[model samples]
Target: MTTIYLVRHGQTYFNRYNRMQGWSDSPLTENGVKDAKRVGEVFKNIKFAYAASSDANRARNTAQIILDYNLANPPKLVEIPNFRECFYGYFEGMNSPETWLLTAHQAGYRTFNDLVTNFDLDYAKDLMHQADPFHEAETADQYWQRLDKAFEFLAKQVSFTSSDPVLLVTHGTTIRSIVGRYSSEKQFDLTDPPRNGSITTIEMNQNRQIKVKDYNKLKI
Candidate 1:
């Protein structure tokens, strides 16, 4: 079986400012550095045969930091754009609260919380894909197709017989999509998002059987 550990990038300045940060770039906050370090510590003992990250700097840097602390010889990092966060289009870099107000209004929601209550947190993502007035954001199918191809590429590079697991550092939405689509656990919910720097473990067999061993585990 091939084991893969998926990690969400640490918090960023945009995350702290409540901004819509898809495709837009931002540096990690001080707390974000600490969070990545903590994740590194937690996985320090595990040797990774393969490692990768989204082309985005936040995810790439987080992956580098974790590998820095890895006791085992870390493999060369593969940076790929296929694992990038969903593009927010016109909403990129906008204050999330204000953006939500506009989105909620367009969706006939009285308030942002109402939208969340009605459609769950994914309402924002739904709006980005389905209701954006500009219609520039990627559709759900597009996003899934991108990730599907990315995973297929990664799986081809991974050997099922390897003892060391593979590691992938990516954004929240990307990680969430994978978990929601592949995890078999009954208790895992798509609406319950993973915290920054959280680790999710998945295993795939030669027969193409995929199993999520752990989902969104924040601590060791």
Candidate 2:
């Protein structure tokens, strides 16, 4: 079985500004760097077989910092475009509250949280896709397609079959959406964004079966 550690990237300028960050690049904030370093320290002893991050600068930088803190030889960091966050199109980089308000109202939701939590989060993602005027935002299907491809890339790696754990640093929404979709454990708080530099652990067998052992943890 392959142990996967899904890490949310550190806080970014967009996160501090409360802006929509999907598929939108942003630099890490001072707090972001510190938090990532803290996470690195927390994981300093755990040896990782492979380390990778999304193509986004925020994700890549966070993974780099964590690898730098590794006590053992850290694997080379790979940048995967398939691991990128969902495309928000017109909503990208907009004020997060304003964007959610627009989508919520258009979807006949009295509040933004109501829209996202009414059904599953994937349904909410489809709702957001529908809300985009440019019609370019990723739908549930598109997001899943990309995610499936990302998994394929991992499975292709020879070291992924080994017992050593692997690290994947990506965006907040990407991590949440993945957990919501695949994790059998439904007790997690999906409404709130995961803490910066938090780790979510998933176990995957050679059969490609995935199981979430934990979510949103500061340390393993």
Candidate 3:
């Protein structure tokens, strides 16, 4: 079996402002740095064999900070661009969550409340499709494909037979995609997105069947 630790990057200015970050590359907030340090402390005793993170600076910084705190001698850090947040296209930097919600409703989507009340695969796909009519944004399928590829790449790079744990630090969307792939679920709960500085763990058998041992443990 292989143990995989998936961590979401710390909070950012965009996160606090409720913006559509996508590939915006915002710097971490002061609170974010503090949160990252706390996350590092939480895993201070755990040693990982390999560490990987999204190419985004937020994720990369989080991985480095965690390693600096935890491992006496950190393993090599690999950058994986595939583990990035879902691209929001032209909507990037937008902070109008309410406008988006209204747009979804106008498009005949179940109301935002209804969508939240009934978060399922069909609902998720509909939201993605309705959100970006021009197809400039990443579709649900594209998001899942990137996540699936990242996991397959990780599995190939790591020694499944070894006991050492592998760490993956990435964005909330990327992490959600990972969970969706493993669970084979079509619709994802809005709550499924991990908060900044949160960690989730999964255990996988040799056959590559994954079991989510823990989900969304936040480090304050």
Candidate 4:
């Protein structure tokens, strides 16, 4: 089995402002830095065979901070552009949650989550497809295709042994995408959101079937 530890990057200025940050960039907040450090402290004793993050600075910096606290020799950090957050197009720097709610309403959804439970629409798949009356966004299909290829590549780097876990630092939506698309967890809700520096662990068999061992658990 291959053990994968997925971590969302620390909070950012955009996050503090409740803005949408897809493909856009922001610096980490004071609390975000502290959260990253705390994550490092939590896993200081565990060694990873591989560490990766999206090409975005937030994810790269978080991975670096965690590695600084790791007791073992850190592996080289790999930057995968495909692992970056979903591109929200015109909504990139807006209030992400608010935009979702408003746009969902425009799309005849009570809320983005309403699309899931009521309309049978997957937000991840349909966000870019909806008529936002603002700007075009990345369709859920495109996002999934990107993630599928990226994770497939990363999984190849993971050793089948359980001895060393792989660390992946990425954005919130990206993390949720990974869990939603690959893991066996059916109740995974992107609306609930993941806390900064939280960890989610997934175990993958040789066939690439993944079982979620943890979901957004913040031990710190």
Candidate 5:
């Protein structure tokens, strides 16, 4: 079995402004630094056998802050491209509300919440991809194709059978996608977004069944 501690990266400047930040890099806000520090404190005593994050600087920077506070010897952070946030194509960096409204209207939904709650992350991605004028946004298949390989990749890079917990810091949407798709809990809604710097625990059994033990938690 493999235990994975998934942490959403700290809040970014784009997040502060309520912008569509998928695949668009943004520096961490002031509070974001504090958020990382708090997570570091929460995990100070735990020794992580492996540490990784999406290639985005926000995730890397947050991982560094948490590692900085670790007293336990932790492995160096690894950057994984598959762990990146869903690419929004032309909607990147645009106002979050505006883009959501546009997509929602096109999808025959009254609101973003309604659209997401009724459908799923994959549906959201497909809608956004279709809405993109240049068709640059990641389709549902394209998005999952990369992310579905993530666990296998990490299991190979880290010791899947090891007893130690693995740290994986990534963006909010990426975390949401994983939980919405693989979480054993059937009641979990796709519209429910994870908080920045939150800890979510997921386990993969020998049969590769993914179960989410916790979601959007402030502490482990």
Candidate 6:
């Protein structure tokens, strides 16, 4: 069995402001840095075979902190852009959730809760289409395809053995996407999203079947 540690990147100013960060590349706050250090200390004993992070700085910084604390000579930190947060399209950097609701309402759509709770991919696709009427960003299909490719690449890159563990530092949405692909849960809970600096542990057998051992559980 191979154990994968999926760590959500630490808090950011965007997080505190209730903004849709998406691909904006926000930096971690001071609290975020401290949380990352604590997370590193908590996982100091485990030696990861390889550490992977999203291309975003938040994720890269978190991965670096963890590796720096644990290993004298850590494995190379690979940046995978495809594993980025969901593309919020026109809503990027928008701090007003109410504004998003208004835009969606005018576009014949309900709130994000409606799409996320109903697991309505069609609604999500429509929202993406309507968000960028001029089409500055990728379509929903394109985003999904990108995530699929990222997962394939990571799986191929990490030749995991029973003795080795893989660490992935990424965004909450990216982690949710991966979980949705394997798990039976159709919709994520909107009321309580994954907490910052939390870890979700997953175990995969030789047949590549996944078992979620823990979710949103932080050692520190």
RMSD of each: 2.6, 1.4, 3.0, 2.2, 1.4, 2.8
Q: Per-residue lDDT of 156-196 in model 2, one digit per residue for the tens? A: 77365477899899988888888887776456778777888
Q: Per-residue lDDT for 45-145 in model 1, tens only?
A: 88898999999999999999999989888888999789999888888898877877777777787555676457644555667656566888777777778
TM-score of the candidate numbered 2?
Answer: 0.95
The residue pairs found clashing in candidate 6 are: none
Deviating ranges (above 4 Å) for candidate 4: 119-121, 132-135, 183-186
Please report, as a residue range, the 10-residue window in candidate 2 with the lowest summed lDDT.
107-116
lDDT of 2: 0.86
Output the better candidate (1/3) by TM-score.
Answer: 1
Show pairs that collide, candidate 3. 120-187, 121-186, 121-187
lDDT of 6 by residue, 1-220 (tens): 6788889999999988888777887889998887788778888888777789989999999889888888545687899898888877776887647645754675565666565665544355456656666655456677778877876777777666647788889887666655655656643343256678888777765455677666777872
For model 2, the superposed segments whose C-alpha errors exceed 4 Å read: 110-112, 158-161
Candidate 6 off by > 4 Å: 71-73, 103-110, 120-122, 186-191, 204-211
lDDT of 4 at 115: 63
Compare candidates 2 and 3 on TM-score and give the better one. Answer: 2
Clashing pairs in 4: 20-94, 20-96, 125-140
Which residue pairs come into collision in candidate 1?
A: none
Q: In each prediction, how many residue pairs overlap at the backbone (N, C-alpha, C within less than 3 A)?
A: 0, 0, 3, 3, 0, 0
With candidate 1 superimposed using the best TM-score fit, by how many Å does residue 30's alpha carbon deviate from the native?
1.2
The true-versus-predicted C-alpha distance at residue 23 of model 4, in Å, is: 0.5
Ranking, lDDT, top scorer first: 5, 2, 1, 4, 3, 6
TM per candidate comes to 0.87, 0.95, 0.86, 0.90, 0.95, 0.85
In model 5, which runs have C-alpha deviations exceeding 4 angstroms?
A: none
Local error of candidate 6 at residue 52 (angstroms): 0.7
Over 1-220, each residue of candidate 3 has an lDDT whose tens digit, in order, gives: 8898889899999999988787788999998888789888987777787899989998899888898898556787899888888777666787747535744575455444455445543355446556666657666777677767877777778888789888888887666656655663444354556879988888876666787766678731
